[model samples]
Target chain A: MKKFSAVLLVLAFSAAALFADGLSLADQGVFSAGGIVIQNDGVFDPVNGQYSTYGQLLHADHANIFYQIPENSNGHSMVLLHGYGQSRMGWMGTPDGRDGWNDYFLRKGYSTYLVDQPRRGEAGQTSVASAISTEPQELAWFTQFRMGRWPLFNMNSQFPQDEESIDQFFRQMTPDTGNIDFDVIKDAMIEVFDKSGPGILVTHSQGGFPGWTTAAASDNVEAVIAIEPGGVPFPEDKLPEPVDAGYYSVGGIPMSDEDFDALIEKPIIIIYGDYIPEDSDLPAERFWRAGLEMAYEFEDLVNSMGGDCTVIYLPDIGIRGNSHFMFQEKNNMEIADVIYSWLDDRELC
Target chain B: MKKFSAVLLVLAFSAAALFADGLSLADQGVFSAGGIVIQNDGVFDPVNGQYSTYGQLLHADHANIFYQIPENSNGHSMVLLHGYGQSRMGWMGTPDGRDGWNDYFLRKGYSTYLVDQPRRGEAGQTSVASAISTEPQELAWFTQFRMGRWPLFNMNSQFPQDEESIDQFFRQMTPDTGNIDFDVIKDAMIEVFDKSGPGILVTHSQGGFPGWTTAAASDNVEAVIAIEPGGVPFPEDKLPEPVDAGYYSVGGIPMSDEDFDALIEKPIIIIYGDYIPEDSDLPAERFWRAGLEMAYEFEDLVNSMGGDCTVIYLPDIGIRGNSHFMFQEKNNMEIADVIYSWLDDRELC
Candidate 1:
């Protein structure tokens, strides 16, 4: 008991420290990268267009809102989520210093807030860097792969000479490499919601898992737009055990038919890449068919418990490129447009 | 024109000689690898309850006609296409080597044929090895990251030095760099189809694209089970000009949409990994999104055009460690079950 309590205290301290060092929405460069003018309310620099840092975004006394108040009001707000290893910067249209989703949302007369969730994006980067510095050998696989070294067996060969070597190579790439603290993230989201009120939550990839978990945990969330969300239970009879200890658990994380029932009551839109296979060379037919089945199951489960849910499938919107990150693609605007239209039509915000 | 004709003749002669000298399917160990058993055939030795060579499965003429059995009283026929740089051995299953899709299908009373497509699998290895005795520097980049090497710049920091560098790294991963001849593949498929009649074409990753292309070009392809078919057109607006001289090309190819329409009226089932994002953290979101969107578009378009198509999304799957390649995972049986069930339900013989 004492050990558990001590661990909790350390976790709490780390959480507080993370908030203190967090990057603001602007300092995180989400808006500036999208060419948006930050309107500051004296706390952070709004004159030079620099908004709050990551810490400020997490612990701001007031809402650090960065949006365009259109002359003709659409009375709508657009929220965007980034995938794994990404921050709110993912919603900001282009990472290559071009117009991003934020500018598009603003231009469409909708309020946009590219929220930087704790333990992700700039914060996550800090954590990863710290981890790498502290555990060089632990991160050697990732580093080696990034540096173009042969970290695993050659996949380009017809028959790899060493199979066990390849298996060991991939055992590494997990998120629990002694870097991120999930408690900090949960608290940050709680704080942000307490201050900002509920709005639409649009997430991509792993971001969708947290978004779903948080939404399920809170009633404040209005709607969810999941672009390749990654957290729901798999269709297989047996589920994979949870790897991460936080909200994104693969284990039976207590999400009941009741939780899905409540979730479906809220409007949820899913957009996934259709070209990916469930298994290698195995077409995604079963998995996707299972997803649709799951959607129906979710809807039925929710409706049975007095909740209304709607699921939409956007086929072939082109999210896969060389690297597999959807936000970095050239047609992010199309994705943004589809999402924006969905939010507007639903009026969830 | 005369010089071109002479070159073509010389190439044809060389290709014939090479094909003659090349390793037979038996020499390449297909029977043992694919778990195929030929009854009443004296060409192969069945030792210790395992077929020793593909000679039993091969016709007297060394053609793949054994797979073209006109009628099976108690079984059906299934064809498997491996991913890039893989061969029939891939279908022989993974680390344990106890479960390949071919065996599963065969055990289910479906005769299975593992195809060695042009420019991929064993064919590619032989071609590439013959073409360049020493591994090409280009090939180094393909396997470097997998081999625990950083295929990019050496930046010690966790965050990319800048977004530009991240974008550059992702860009390097996109170019097409394989020596497989698509024309040769198409011809081979045509030859096989001519003898085999209509059958289900199962493809993974890069194999999906060519599978779809082949299905769209041939009338004998009854259905396509595309496992994570990569390279579908994304963001309808950004489609590239088809380079090959084919009916699907925008400018060069003789095969047009009309030809595809005539050939492909069959069902297409796409199976994809649900948790994996198609892009990495880079400035290619639009490109990736385009790919995703295009995959969806392909589904809808094909269906709208009288071809039945479906996309299946599998959960808890990633690029490595129980993801990416299908034949490697322990759940390959479940994957096979899904494909077989889909085929059975559709009544596609």
Candidate 2:
């Protein structure tokens, strides 16, 4: 069978080469977080087209990871976790058809494992079910993502503003099949890191919390690159007061000293895009400001605790016009380079 | 933006060409079944991360499709839909690591659009929720799929029976987020055809029902190639008596004459794998026999109604050792060739 696979692999690649003119990959496949079995004692009723789960195994609550290893691999994989109402697609390509962060990094010789977190996207099977809110929330997310007010763009916004682009963007927002559970998410992600071995961990939006937890819990997350993370981590003993952002508090997750120290032991970077006003009457802007405030506190705390942490406010760094999804904006490659440079500096690339 | 995209396209292709030795796709991207808008009347509260649905659009019940257009593609694409508890992954590759039907058809100069049916796989968002059953049913499915009974294999079974292969095979099984609704599925599929233009429809197992309905409802389906369809379609007025198979009835769906006629308008072919016993006390085998029996009836009914239909019993045609998922077995290419020949004869490829 192994020999058969080798022949087929060669034939497959050769056939691909024959076609020519697109991405060449050394390997690409998928894996899951694993599952459990349910032994049933039901009987088969053939007369009604009914059968028992009698000897069948039901696999559930597992995360799905789709990975691609480019030719001449770097041997270091980047595990990408997406934010709320989002999936691995967000990192695969931009709504406007531009190459996303995945391609950019792939070109730079890094393997990418794009994750569909448990209860979301391809990893939709869950132990607990949730009513998928079909409530219109695209506009809300647009504002929250800092793309701009409805049907309007922040001045010089890096997001592609064409109608098709916006439509595609909204279509990419997926609902969770189950209520979000941090522990469930972290466990699955740790398994991913375990399978992929030690590599960089990159999280965006809602994934940040679990990314941190997973990174701290597993030895496989060598470094962390967070893009507009929804929140940061704080020491449990010295938790900061929640910052009032009008509707929501901007308090980060409290963690044990051991977990905190383990997290800080590795290099960490938090990135914030443009359009997050320092102070605003607008709720979206105001909430983001509070979130940023917490990030600053996180940075100070991590560094003070002998951890390496860097916060890059895109505007302050003179790379402006980014919305919350900087890695998916028109200037996505530029933003990716910042991440690449950071990894390079640490010899972790 | 168009020019920018063009430039990126050229650069991306060239970059791919430089690497060589793997799949060279002219274009590959994702599109979704269109969704709805929820006009929410609400307010945003910044202090507690609370926001209203005002101006937000909620998209629901849309199917997700990932497509790859090979270089110098044949205009007639193949839209691949999966079976019960399975996703598009089944058609992409085998659990034992081998190229799947998609690659075979692609190499034959056909584009492939793999579908994750509404509320399943990547299309997990649904209007209604269902509890995910995480029972141990791998052995049951193994038997049901005719790969073999648990801890056993049918004589000369073509299934990859290695432990890892078995594990991966079971892991690929996914649960539906909601109850199965053929109308909803057909609706989403019709949209896929609408987007991709007229194409050949290929379906496996449970997908076969919706495949027929979608083809009936839309002119976009030029032909259909069904691999072990779960059941055939029957005329509503002349619905056949349900066949007693011990545990389940093997009666096909009843459709309006117009819909039935519309479905039969396209050339159709049904292929069943080996090991279906003419008489069996074993529920799985008995049930499959009944399913095959219906296929024969469906063939006669369609042909009698002045429509084209054919059934291929693999063993009768000198092919053997195939389980239900013949396309994912070692001889997947051979089975795909059978499909290609059918489409080619119809000039649909």
Q: Largest DockQ belongs to which candidate?
A: 2
RMSD of 1: 28.1
Tens-digit lDDT track for model 2 on A145-164?
88766667889998987665
Clash count, predicted structure 2: 42
Candidate 1 per-residue lDDT over residues B78-158, each given as its tens digit: 667666543434553332323456545544545456665532222221112122111112212211112111233222212
In the range B226-335, model 2's lDDT, one tens digit per residue, is: 99998998988777888887557889798988999899999999999999989976788888899998899899989998999999999998889999889889888888
TM-score of chain B of each: 0.58, 0.90
Cα lDDT tens digits, model 1, A1-349, are 0001111211121100111111111110011111001111223221121222311111111111122233333555455545544334345423222345655555565546555443222221121222211111222222211211123222222111232222212211112112343333444443344323466666765566556665665566678777655545322333444443211223422455555555655777766543333332211223333444454454454456565455544344433321123343455566667777777677642
Q: After superposition, how far is residue B234 of candidate 2 from its true place, in Å?
A: 4.3
Candidate 1: list runs displaced more than 4 Å.
A1-349, B1-75, B119-130, B133-178, B233-255, B282-290, B316-322
Q: What is each candidate's DockQ, to 2 decimals?
A: 0.01, 0.19
Looking at model 1, residue A136 earns an lDDT score of 14
The candidate 1 chain A region of ten consecutive residues with least summed lDDT is A27-36
Report every candidate's CA lDDT.
0.39, 0.76
